[model samples]
Target: MTRFAPFLLLALVACGDNDPRYLISAPAETGTAGQVALRVATLEVRQVSLPAYAAEDEILREDETGALKPVQGALWADTPPRAMTQLLADRIAARSRAQVAAEPWPLSTPAQALVDVRVSELAARLDGQMHLTGQFAISSPDQIVRERIAPFAIAVPLAGDTPAEIARATGRALEQLAEQVIATLRR
Candidate 1:
């Protein structure tokens, strides 16, 4: 027992260190200046789907081989899919000035339009950029024809190599992606 005292003490000290928890939230809502008037009345946003690596709670970084590695001591308050879905919902609602409901659509009736998004890549790259690449599909009850799927890729340069900077960059990338989706819907 005496020989293991130092190891035990070290373990205790390491456990006491406070690890910071970060939140990947929607970028601040921006005005719809110069945006086209909304065409759809009500929009329903489905839960954003993410790849297995991105769906993890820990923040991930992309390696050169296109693999993801979790950043040490870095974590997200929520999973990527759930967080991105909330962001998309808020952004669409604000930009289009339309009623947007998230999954489990809490309405008595179906929405006029439905938005489905899938994020295949969402991580900070070794080159110091936050990347967000995904595809979105829009379906409307009013459209007689089937809608085509739209794909988008967004990258925002990181202020630094720190995890906090990565989080901010990720938020910016998400906002840009949301803006693109809103634009496509307007068109």
Candidate 2:
């Protein structure tokens, strides 16, 4: 029994809590479901640029001191840049007549327009709001559509400080951004 005790302790240590809990930012809800006219038929979305903290796997929260802190035991289910790029493409496509895809431009034919988004801030703030601020530019290689650079700042009230609530707020913010982008494409 004494010899087995050592092995039992080792097994217990190995089974201890070392794995991080992964949280997913839910896909943006399809808002006002209807196709809107777009200047371009095919749109390519470049990889989104996220802030250093925002790009990290650890979920961060802005504390009262205005410093970002990681939420212990919580990690993002997917890479932020890739996830956000795909999210934007999906959201935009659902709301517009255009077919949108994340870059590498899946189709053999060239895309009519390209979208690049740079996110300066994306965080759950101390004030119980999820803030998303950034600039997005649309360009056309063949001049099929007019080029434009638009800035966006979105905030969604957080129901609670939990990671799940933060993710929900993030989704809502992205939904708002998608709507704004679609509106721009309509012009």
Candidate 3:
């Protein structure tokens, strides 16, 4: 009975850990205030590939020694890769006239360009700065354009030392990432 009592108590304590889930996404560029003109007709954004640590659902912070520490009581609403992919699709679609679709292109007609992103760093640092670094490649169906991979890095300053601030900084980094992708596609 003593052993059973300990197990029950542990289970009850575990059930009480309900942490809030945070979502990582870039804001839509829906407004025409600062939108760049449409450059591509159709674009397919493939599933974003991320490193093992960054792919986790938890909000991770990097220390000076390069150790990853999960933010207590905070998690991502969805896997980082999926969230990032959808966010990129939305941002690209809004900024351009291209019909953006995620993996397994849903349209009857094929996409004109395919965008692939590989994220290496996507986390907030102990110093209150969020950084995003990755390489992306754009490929066209036709042989008219040659495919090339470009590296991009963006850092956003946090407004305060809070989880919400970290999330906002992450959003800003994502926004910059989307802009870089769009610019690269145009070039």
Candidate 4:
């Protein structure tokens, strides 16, 4: 059991990736109809937040008031936001039946629906918890169409938890979120 202990015990037990599959969700009342759901071919991961600040394996010991506690987690990912954006794109593609390309949308008059995902937060707690988030915006050059927050969080349990396990949980949350966003945008 010890050999497989890491795999057996996982926080937010999931299938793939360390980042949560999440979709910054718009309120149920909102919908982007008349919008042709095009492919989210690429995601340029801009540094909204510094990576060195949230290194993998560095336990995130937050100060009181829910601030990001100083410290690090047990493990880390080379590029958390990048990994998550890709994972989310994949999920959104699968769920919304939208074609996902590796390249960005072709610059033209306007895209049917343009999706931009921004990581609002991605980190692990010193106490052992994982969080992944993204904000989605459907917009055009002239107008801002819609927006929402895709945040996922789960505890890193002492038992049945490993770095890999949490990673998968993270991925799952992102995937689900992306799928949801795609659905709304496509609708």
Q: Mind giving the per-residue lDDT tens digits that candidate 3 earns over 102-181? A: 87799898887888999888778877789889899988877445677999988898787566677778878877888888
Clashes of 3: 0
lDDT of each: 0.78, 0.86, 0.80, 0.46
Please list the residue runs of candidate 4 whose C-alpha ends up more than 4 Å from where it truly belongs after superposition: 1-52, 55-78, 102-111, 126-129, 142-161
Q: Could you tell me every candidate's TM-score relative to the true structure?
A: 0.81, 0.85, 0.83, 0.48
Candidate 4 matches the true fold with a TM-score of: 0.48
Better of 2 and 4 by TM-score: 2
Clashing pairs in 1: none
Compute the lDDT of residue 140 as modeled in candidate 3. Answer: 86
- In angstroms, what RMSD does candidate 4 have relative to the true structure? 11.9
lDDT of 1 by residue, 53-164 (tens): 8888777787679778788888877777778788778877777767887886888877877889888888788878888888999888778325668999888998886668
lDDT, model 2: 0.86
Q: Which prediction has more favorable lDDT, 2 or 3?
A: 2
Q: Is candidate 3 or candidate 4 better by lDDT?
A: 3
Candidates ranked by lDDT: 2, 3, 1, 4
Cα displacement (angstroms), candidate 3, residue 164, comes to 2.0
Residue 27 local lDDT, model 2: 60
Error of 4 at 145 (Å): 6.3
